[model samples]
Target: MNRKVIVTCALTGAGDTTGKSGHVPVTPDQIAADAIAAARAGASVVHIHVRDVETGQGSRDTALYREVVRQVAASDVDPVINLTAGMGGDLVIDPANPTVALEGTDLVSGLERLVHIEELRPEICTIDCGSLNFGEGSSLYVSTPDMLREGAARIRELGVKPEMEIFDTGNLWFANEMVAEGLIAAPPLYQLCMGIPYGAPVDAGLLQAMVNMLPEGAQWTSFAIGRNQMPWVAQSILLGGHVRVGLEDNLYLSKGVLATNAQLTERAITIVESMGASVATPDEAREILKLDKVA
Candidate 1:
């Protein structure tokens, strides 16, 4: 329990949570402010996703990303920046015509999804491993095997560490296959996402099994949404992995208490410290994840 734990604060996700919690930052300035605060509060990394200023919904606009990164880069703190390349894969299918996509769909090519990543060139970007029923609807997050392969190879070529996002056992299996094919470079990094609908449930035994399935020398982190956020920090640490928390996954710090990004990160640090493990600094996290520090 004397290990150093890397704490990643996911500032804002592409989920429909902006209305649910006032703490969820929408504009670039707000997101950047939250990131700087979280880093000052002892988070090792900041996972970012920009939102449209007017609609308050998630956006893949490179301009929005540019603004957010610019603000954070100009800030005093220097937490490792981890951009979300998991956007542009959402496909909300039409009920009658399954072949035709619905309005909510933002489906695009795998390379298209990396447009922002290519421009920003952050230290870390995410590639969701496989497709899944995103939530309790006709929505399906599409990341086909071919798409994943193309994305991984591109990310590797760009010299950005790709965080293989494992939603379920199938995603993990495909990720291993990518490693075997030498698409993912040495010291691969993974994020074991749990408790999302139609994905891996929040079960310790299942998490242990997934951890066991990971290739040797792989660096991994895990997180669950809603009430499971705080508990999953200990769960990930106990299983020898890093942790992520923030408004993206959970709105409340406790029941009936809406929490900000900084608050969640502070609580995560407390948990890590209480368990006899120290929270990793940004540099320490870069070393652990084998990331090339952006200058």
Candidate 2:
């Protein structure tokens, strides 16, 4: 009962789930609305990823990001805004010529991926730690060591805390190196992404090992996709970490039930409270994470 958990609800991700669930937000207005609703539902933070309004695909458009941030900041309810700076790393290789990048490829420099983050300067932004074979396809997510070093330094300069995204043990190892090198500030933030194909498998032993490897005083959280989502919430809390939920990593409230951002947030709160841990408010989360109030 002495624990206070920060609940972050990722409103919409840059995934291909818009077709699978009608509740997935597409436009800036929808994303903003979802963010506000999630805040009202007891979420201390809202993780955002804009999408192309017409195509409903994930986008890196600065304008779309500006609009979404504007609406959320202007709203009555306050939640720590965390933007995704992990875009522009997709590399779909051509089957005919392995050296050739495919049409769907959006590979760019790590700095290029931070265009919006550089402009908007939210309280927090994510930095994917390493490259990985993204899912079952020719697609690969790239973030080399050089790219990570540059990106981490730039984010520190911007006064935006970088949420180091750890997809595997190797990623965690490199992230620890960055912390040791003084690129990341005190109390480094980490997001242990589990159940993502070709990354870290959904294993509790692996999660515990990664937790043991974290830098001392590091603030961390873990999440799994699909049905494993809620269970991971309990697991993360049990292991002395925060929690993240929403359409980004999960879509169902129960079997055959699609969930909205707010619904997922409420569910996460229920889990937290039932576990004898209270959900932190926006201001409380800011203090816990050492983030300045941007909005």
Candidate 3:
């Protein structure tokens, strides 16, 4: 067993899950508090996504992101901050016309999407590798190749580490292409997002296939949503990778049991420890991720 494992807590995602679980943080203050709690519970890194306080809907407002980042940085529990650059890519196309976009569509330029990351300059920011059918129906999470390259360039210019988010085999291949194109720096960081609808399935074979395609000396982590969340924590560690967990991906410790972000993180820690692996602290994660030293 690998002696050291890093646990990352995705504090809040952009999904429409606020009403489904009381643990999902909707406001800036709640998001900051939840992140701190997860850090205290054993998470080395915290993935963040802010929301509209008034409607509890996912938002791409820089002000909300600023507040969340400020609060998390000021808190006693200091975990490496990894902000999502995956917003503003939702494209709801009209099924009938196929040429027109639906009312709820929110598409923005690649530069516009990275505005928050450029302003805040977090330790790490996610760069979604490729486009995919988000789920059943007319929606698509659009991340084109040109957009990915632009995002990666901007993140590199800002000295922010880009955490390449791979949702399928094609996405993983494109990520390696980015590495080949010199868009990503050395020792690239990757996050394999599994079991998210039309993407990859949450099975050992699929996970191994994704891992096998990683470039030599790449630093990577893996996670699955819903019921596969906890299981993937152990699977990741056993496969010589890091793990991610939180209310963002799942809201229950078990069936009929709601869980707080801290609870989810603690559970992941327990699983890692049970496998004879010690959790990596935030400072250690910073070193491992090669983050720019906070001044």
Best of the candidates, lDDT:
1
Off by over 4 Å in 2: none
Per-residue CA lDDT of model 3 for 1-295, tens digit only, reads 4568889999889888999998899999999999999998989999999999998888899999999989988888889999999999999998899889997798998889998987898989998999999999999999999998888988888998999999999999999999998988877999999999899988899998898999998999999999989999989988889999997899899999999999999999999998989999999888777778555
Instruction: Please give the lDDT score at residue 138 for candidate 3.
Output: 95
True lDDT of residue 189, candidate 2: 96
Per-prediction tally of clashes? 0, 0, 0
Residues 7-45, model 1: lDDT tens digits:
999999988999998899999999999999999999999
Q: All models: lDDT?
A: 0.94, 0.93, 0.91
Lowest summed lDDT window (length 10), candidate 3: 286-295
Instruction: Please give the lDDT score at residue 57 for candidate 1.
Output: 88
Off by over 4 Å in 1: none
Overall local distance difference test of candidate 1:
0.94
Stronger candidate by lDDT (1 vs 3): 1
Estimate the TM-score of every prediction.
0.99, 0.98, 0.98
lDDT tens digits, residue span 224-283, model 2 = 998999999999999999999999888899999999999999999999999889999999
